[model samples]
Target: MTRKIWVFDTTLRDGEQVPGAKLNLYEKLEVAQQLKKLQVDIIEAGFPASSAGDFDAVKEIATKVGNTSDLMITALARAVKSDIDAVYNSVKYAEKPLIHIVLGTSDIHVEKKFGKSKSQILNIGVEAVKYAKTLLPDVQYSTEDASRSEFEYLWATIEAVVKAGATMINVPDTVGFAEPEEFGERIFKLNDRLKNLNDKVLLSVHCHNDLGMATANTLAAIKNGADKVECTINGIGERAGNAALEEVVMAINTRSSIYNVHTNIKTKEIMNTSRLVSSLMGLDVQVNKAITGENAFAHSSGIHQDGLLKSRDAYEIISPVEVGLDDMELVLTARSGRHAVKNALEKLGFHQITNSQFEGIFEAFLELADAKKEVYNHDLYVIVENYYAKQDVHNENMTYYSDHFYELMDLQVISNINFPSASVKMKRGDQILKSSAVGSGPIDALYSAITEISELDIKLIEYNISSVSRGKEALGKVKIQVEYRGEKYIAKATETDIMKASALAYINAINSIVVDQLLPVE
Candidate 1:
């Protein structure tokens, strides 16, 4: 039997630290459920010591999602007893709770960040592990900026923490400073050096993408002796971001023979999980990012197209199907009936549809099919989600997909040689708000109209337009980035009308700023 790799996902904790990537309590729960479905071995829920809101959110996830799954849920804390206490209080409800502790041991970190001596820093790290062990058997210890720490000091710190009862030791390329081979050899030597302590101590790696080698470095560490990998969905984190979970998992699975390791990740949930994170977090994954990027499986060049048509292996190593993407050229037109929609949903792996649910899905599908010449798989997912939002079903889908604080009730835009203008009708709870504005273009006009209604100080940062698939009938997608009070927010929408998509996308982003931004902590 091949050795198992523990997939530790920190999308909620570290990934949520990104400015304006906040997920409300409900959104966090939704993400936790999805991660559970993704079959990650561990979930770092949050840094409970940071804020009262974080503490409550972590406790809620442990009590709700953690109780149902075999997932080992945890929260991060500093070496201080207060921080550890907050973590313990939040994670105590989990069946398998873990406490993650971190203290920088590098000369620069010790001197500059902590203003402490090397011995003092080492003592802090060890004490944290010791105290965390008393609370939970599953304790993880990370050396902040481990790549930059002195090798001897780092090794000594690791041995001390392991002796202090840390079941997992994470060596983080905190600033993404380590090159792949160097990082790999570091893990190898450390694992070799710590062998005498006990075989139960698991070595782990957490590599950031500052140098664009996070995935490479993580894979290299796994190739050496690391037993666990820490990552986030869509590679979202501070600065350049952390290693992407999809990329690391696919790399290991594709070259399993090279590493001779296996992970419990449900390979099929990769695409959906990536999309869910991207949508809720409002951070679009770069189109060219590896694994879950929009262009990961796309072939555009003539030579590449010919090669792909001749033999899929010529240019592709991972099929779209393996990652929950349906590449089948299936299309549904306005004439397609209920039976056809049902079959299409089944083909897309969406099963267990009740009669009422099918009725709703089919109705939404017909509406979309009428707007476009043909509706594809991506369109179906959106249709079903939109239907979920409209329904009063009181189910998970309804709660997860419902409007934030604003919903687009109606929109109209006109762009002519004279000028561009737009009108918007939206709802905020029981209020019907209508506004209109003129801009240089249709999207600008829509955003201007929305800004007028929102009456919020927002600066437009970036606007991107994409398609669900190729061809003229493809669904138009618009993703907009805006800044309010120095925090960045992004939102996207898809529709047959680019103008409508633009309107809804901007409205969605503003809604996030209103709802998530104004949410009272605690």
Candidate 2:
């Protein structure tokens, strides 16, 4: 029988520790829902004792998702009674609540970070586990930097925690300092020496990517004896990152013949889950990342292309469809032919194209091919989607006056060595409004001008800009969140010019505010 490996997702706890990668309450809820869809066995929500906001997030997740799903919901806590209490309070409503208590056990961490000796660390770990068991039956204990701890001491600590009622023992390569072979050996030795280890408790591994070997080390541990893998989506976490949930799951799936292990993850949801995490976290996966990157299924070279065309097994190990890629992307470049473009469009859900539409799209594709080194699926989708959106707007007569809307008329800005000033004209309903204001920067001045004309007291909370396509003249997309009368609204707009995109995005947000007011109160 194949061993069942549990996936413990710490995207909300460890993954959020990445500097400046904070997710608000709603964002956390969204990620939790996706994690459920990913079918992770455990979701470590957050450290409830850290902040009221974190506490609320954990509580809400525990109530909303935990009660509804079969998966266990957990929260992290230091090996302190107060922290354990907070964890219990936050997740008491969960269907299967777990409190993960950790302590520093390595010589450096115990001596320098906590000024506690090995005996003190063991005592703390035992006390915390015993206390946590009083509140929740399922308790997990981790000796921080377990990879660097002395072997005998680590074993003693584990033995103590298990005796204190810890159901799971996590060995973290806290600083990502372990090689694959060494890490595997450690887990194997622990499994060998620990009395009734597998029967009494599950052995888990949480490896970081500081040495860029998180996935390798994790696989090695699983090969040896680990029954659980703690990881974050897209490998996001402190410093380098934790093992990526996607990489590990896909690794086990692709090489199941060798590993002979299976996880509970819904493999088809992998790509969508990866995208959601990246979007909410504002982090981009590297192009060459193992499974969920942009170029993961992209074919470039002619020889490789020929082999792929003949048989995917010639060069590809994992089918794109297996990881929810749906279709493999053979990039459309100058070297690509009509067959490739036709196949690409068909895969993009643009089948049944008329001769005229095909001709137009092909012409546009040729132009894009000349301009860009490679035309991506997104570029193709944008081209096709924009064409349809424009056609719909024309056919439906979807003018701004049809609703509570604002349209940008004209914008002018002057930015010299001094403070920047902007002038703007906008059409609101049947009225034309104009205003001028000076600000610290051109974008700031433009927003100030718009605010003055609209006369709505709104605070800009967040603004992000990115290019929709590749090139000097690529379309710029702007997304902004604004607070109006204690309510928040998000709006997005795209334009060839970035400044225009910014202005349009702000106006769109203001329009949403107006529309919200007209809606009947629930």
Candidate 3:
């Protein structure tokens, strides 16, 4: 049987440190629920000793709904009584609580940072772990700079903490200096030298990605018998960041044959969880990011497209579907072949194109492809509409505004009455006009002004407002559809202020007439 590797996600503790990535208590709880669904073996909730807010967040998470029985919920602490006490208080309500106490072990760290001798440092590590064990049986002791610590001192610190009842010993690559092979060999040598190491506690690895090798180093450490890998989602952390939980988990699962390890992660939830975190944190993953990027599965070019069509394995090492992504795309460009066009149409549910129809549309698409540089889905829709037009079939149906006027009889109405001060002008058929009047709100005033100036009298048929995205900073989106000159025009605009949104929406509608030629009834 393959041994189960513990997946320790420190997203709450370390990922929260990313600049501008702060999550309030509710957001943190939402993320914590996602981590739980990911089936991580442990969650380092936060450093409760950091501040009162941190303590409250940790404490609330410990007591909140869905604090499961088997999962080891944890909080980080310094190897000091006050810090340990803060962690203990926060996690006191949890069924299985882990107190993670960390202290520096390297001589340089001791001398420069702590001004303590080697023996004093060892005593502090032992005393802290022993004391924490009394409060909670599951105590994890970490050597902050274990990768750079002198071998003898590291071994001594490990032995001391183990004897002090530490359940797990974490060796961190604090500055991410160790190479993969060297770091793995270090764990192997420690296991060899300290024969009682496995007898007393499990070995864990905490790596940073300063050298962009954090995941590799972590896997190597696991190969050398480390039982737990500490990481964060999306590689978020201080400075260069930490190993990404998604990357590490996928690597372990995808290469299980080579590594002979497994983690209890719900692989399918990877993409959804990444998106949720990205949205809540307000960090947009780059289009080319691995695993969850928009372009991760997108393929272009004639050669690759042909090869991918033959067999996905020809160009893809891992199936996009394996990472909860859809099949690769074959976009039509000037270089695209007939196979690409047919395939794109088939995907869009447009099957069985006649020879003449295909030729006509293909020729027109090429012309459009030349003009636009790349034919998009919307362009394809236009081509299809034109084809249907020759068949005398209705490609689209129009609605009369008077038909739906009764639906607005008793609906809730909130109008913008406080119109901002502005100069208004409108024109039609060589008429320059100007007028202003306050109505129920700015939107009403703007409409009155536009009517006076343009003299292209139209009735306000429909208006709606929505948000481009969620949050206080979200852009308010406004859409207006109005009838004039026996035609209807739709216009849209997004802005932070409602008044600006109203003005922009009106302008967008008017531009649809003046600029895009979707003129309304005069």
Candidate 4:
């Protein structure tokens, strides 16, 4: 029989530790609702003792979501009475409330950070669990940086915590410094040596992504003996971040033959949850990121597209719809052949085309592909629509070109050793708006000026620039992703001047947002 793997999501606590990724009370509540929808076994709402705001958030989540969701609500605390009491106060209203207490057990942490000996650390952990058990029935104890600690001492600490009434013990790869084999061996050895305690209590693993091996290390632990995984949404956390909850859950779901384990995650909610987290945090998921990225299910290669068109399983291991995505995307590129082009055109509702028209469109597609990295559905629609529009004009029919809702008129930037300033002129319909602002850098000033002129409260989630062709005067392509009113919009532009490309890209993204708002819902 396969083992049941519990998912404990710490997005509100550990994930929030990422710099500049703080969530306010309403945002916290929003994320907690999504986590509930995701069906995680436990939600580590926040560190209540950290601040009054966190305490209120935790309390609110516990009362609003946790009590009704039938899932456990937990909060982080150090191995201290005050911290444990704070957590207790925050989560006490939940139907199932848990107190999670952590202590540093590694030699470096013990001697340097805590200035305590091994025995002292062990005593504190045991006492903290015992005290926590008095307040909550479910108590979880974590030994910080357990991967680097002495094995024997770590086993002794686990035994002590379990004996002191800790129902769960989390052995974390705190610094993400352990390899999979070694981490697996550590868990296997602990379970082998402490059979009585291991059989009675749950063994959990929390891994960081500093080494980009958190998911691998976590899989090793689960394969060995771990019963729970401590993770965060989109892997957002301190340093490089924690192991991603979606990745781990999907890994187990997709590779059940190997791991022989399953999770309680509602797989269909994965993408929605990821988007919600990314939007609220003002972070952009990388295009090539696994599982929930923009390009995760996008096929661009000719051979891959051919195989996918024949059968989805020929190229995709998991269906996009399984993760809440609408469908797979066959992105048209220079690498795409005639069949791929026809397929894309059909998807864009351009099914009928003469051979000559097909040749012309394919030629134009090649030119566009040479200029851009990838051609989107919108670009293909524009190409086909323009072709028919030209035909209509040749037949002496009237045609109207759609005007841009927002257009950039002029931009002037001044940068020096002191303060940098920028001025921008924008045209919206019959109105010409002008604004100027000062910033720490030229791009910042320019963006500030644009925002001031447009009056759109947007957050720049991602900015990337690359050369379309290699030369001294290479055509620079700028891609910008921005978030407005909880929605993400991406736009790209190319120009000889990098700054010009950047300004155009920013304004184009703003225009795309406006267009989306103006579009009629189907």
Candidate 5:
């Protein structure tokens, strides 16, 4: 039997609490809508009593996104009356309103953070849950740093809150200190203890990634009978961040034989959601981050690529299509072997090639791979093109063109004047596109001309420049981050002309969108 794991997304709450990852009301609402599309069980909008801005954002999400969808709306509160009241007022209009009351039960938090005794914390948590239960049927109480708290004290707090009508009992490894085994034991014991009190109450675990074991600990708890997971998108939260929702959900899904549980998350929406949160929050998801990372399903090693070509299961445990990718990426890099190179060629429609021809191409590939970190398709194309030219084979199929949606053919910019203007010539397949625009600045004007020609809803969020080498004539390197339909794409270009470098960098990002990364609009 597959048990359904409840996914409570706190991206708008704990995730936004990161030092500089805060989002405006519009952005929060955008995330809530995306979360709803992702089919998370609950959305913790924000800590309402934290500020007027948060209160308004939570209220708006509850009334608009929450009430319109089947998802539950919730917010965090200390085990204080005023905090619980603020949460209630904000999410009152939600169809399924949940108030999350967190309090410290560990001796460290009780003595140092709150300066209160165990009994005082217990009373405050019980009173808060009791009040929240009066307003909504769903109320969760978290034992802050429960892993470090005395078992007896933690049990007593659990018994008290269950008695006070907390529908969900959350045990958080608040500081991410607990190992998987230790965390799982706590959840198992709590489940057993709660069976005698109120088995109907849910058992939830929230883990942090301080020791880089949050996903491991979370899976361990689920194995020991935790019914709910408190997580955030892209794992954005305090300090080292919370257990990533995508990692946890996909773990349960991919390794169902071990955990025998499933989540409501539509895994197909995982990529879009991760990109949306990363873009709006102005945080970049690490390329190697699990699940939604750039290289999660990308294979680069020679042995791995060979096995992957033979069978996906030889190296990949999960299919890229399962998480909404069209196919697993076989990255051509220095480590990639000849087998991957041949497959790359076949994928580019060079399927009918002589074995000797392929061998000739392979040698050239190795030389280029040694000189570069990764070989793009264009680089591979040139290798093949040069191979044919050396062989004196007039191959009509051999062309310098690619499947790029937009290629910068030419660029002309005029700046240091009242009206900073630029004209761009681009190629999309066989068609030529020419556009000109004036902006408040030179880079802005170049981007405007590109945007006008591409007709994409591309937003330039991050722009940076640096020098590849020293001196006045040093190669100016431009790096840019752009958002397309909520997903972020990064591109870099180096040129002696700073303005041309900026244009090429921006076009590289746009071409990335047009090539393979244009996520479908939900």
Candidate 6:
């Protein structure tokens, strides 16, 4: 029998507690929609009372994104009336609104924190849930530290909240202490010992990642009959984090026979959600983190790759494509075969290179293959470019040009503007002035002198450099774009050194301008 699990996403509520990981309102809404598509049953959008921004985000998500039949939007609140009011206000427009009211339940929290007796805390939990029910029919109640609370006290409190109108009860392993067996036993006992256990409300588990056992504990909870699992994208939260939605879902999927569980998650959107969160949070997911990591499905070594090529199941328990990961890479190392090289080139977006071009590029590749013992994409790009560059500009249409070299006071001197490559030197009557100079850097010096000599004042807008050939002996290519007399010119060149690269680049820019028949302002 396939069991069903409800996914509760708390990315906005708890994930925001991560320092410097706050998402703006628009970003929050974007993620919330993604979660809805992921088919999360409930989304704890935010702690509405925390800030005006948080309040607005919760309200907006609740109003704009949530749908009634398939999804529910929720706002978190402390047991305080003001917090409850804020939460209620935020979710008022939600088609399926849920108010989550949480209060301290452990002995330590009751004494030092709220300074209330156990009975008083119970009363507060009941009253809070009751008040939340008045605002919204669906209310979720959480005992802040249920895992650490005494079992008898926790059971009595759970009974009180359910009686007081909490539609769901969230039991959290606050400190992430319980191991799988013990936690499963605890939940199993809760159902066995507690009265009206299944009749009153749904039972959910919220596990943390403090001991690196959140996913395990959550599974244990489900093994013992937890109806919902609370999690976040990438497992991001206050401490080590919550159970990753991807990990738990895939686990249940892979071991469905044992857990007998299924969730509404699309499974494919796991990668997209992981990437969006990583991008917004500016936190790089480790290459081997888990299901969505870059190298999660990567296999290296001759034996493994060969086995994978033959049949993925030979070495892989899960297909990379199933989780949106690209298939195995046949990187060109010293030990790589010809088939590997062909495969690599194909994967490089060059599926249809001419045989002549491939032959020329391959010869250089063999030379590079002898040195580094591995061929990267950059090395291949350079090899291909060298085969394509035209040497002489005599027959071709030419436009703009300039020169640069270093000068005193860290200034740049540019000179020797030319076009058509055939018109080398210019004459001013019998004066016959030649353009040349030196500057700080070769380009700077060349540009400064060129400015003095060209009689065409130009302001450089952009410049770029790259290698056009393979190995250290490869030629450097420079591209310069400049604005002269309200006209833009682009220059490019292949050269041995950067100084030559700069000269050619400027010349290329001037060539573009001249080719276009552009003239400087008078």
lDDT per prediction? 0.83, 0.85, 0.76, 0.86, 0.87, 0.74
TM-score of candidate 1 relative to the true fold: 0.68
Each model's TM-score, in the order given?
0.68, 0.72, 0.73, 0.79, 0.85, 0.69
> For residues 31-145, could you state the per-residue lDDT of candidate 1 as single tens digits?
9989998999999999998899899999999998888556989989988999999999999998888898888878889999999899998898888888888888888899999
Candidate 5 global CA lDDT score:
0.87
Q: Give the TM-score of candidate 4.
A: 0.79
Q: Please report how far candidate 1 places residue 17 from its true position, in Å.
A: 1.3
Collision pairs in model 4: none
Please write out the lDDT profile of model 3 over residues 433-474, one tens digit for every residue.
456566766567667766655446778876767666878888
Model 2 C-alpha lDDT per residue in residues 1-522, reported as the tens digit of each score: 899999999999999999988999889989999999989999999999999999999999999889855699999999888899999999998899999998877899989998977888789889899889989889999889999999899999998889889999999999999999999999998877653654768899999999999999999999998989999999999999999999999999889998999999998899878878888899877768989987889876656666677787988988889887767767667677665677767754556666776767777777887775566554565555455565552424222333345678999988866989999998755788899989989989999999988789999977778777998779877878789999876676678888888998888788767655643354
Native-to-model Cα distance after best TM-score fit, residue 268 in candidate 1, in Å: 0.7
User: Candidate 6: deviation at residue 323, Å?
Assistant: 2.7
Best by TM-score: 5
How does candidate 1 score on lDDT? 0.83
After the best TM-score superposition of candidate 2, give how far the Cα of residue 157 lies from its true spot, in angstroms. Answer: 0.5
Error of 3 at 401 (Å): 22
Cα RMSD (Å) per model? 14.3, 9.3, 10.1, 5.9, 4.9, 12.3
Question: Model 1 segments beyond 4 Å from truth?
Answer: 328-411, 414-522
- How high is the lDDT of residue 29 in model 2? 89
Q: Rank order by lDDT, top first?
A: 5, 4, 2, 1, 3, 6
Tens digit per residue, CA lDDT, model 6, 336-442: 54445555556545566667666766777778777655455434544554545432224232221211211112222333443112111333223443455554455
Q: What is the lDDT of residue 329 in candidate 4?
A: 80
Model 6 alpha-carbon drift over 4 Å, by segment: 193-196, 326-522
Error of 5 at 191 (Å): 0.5
Off by over 4 Å in 4: 372-522
Q: After superposition, which runs of candidate 3 have C-alpha atoms over 4 Å from their true positions?
A: 326-338, 354-376, 385-522
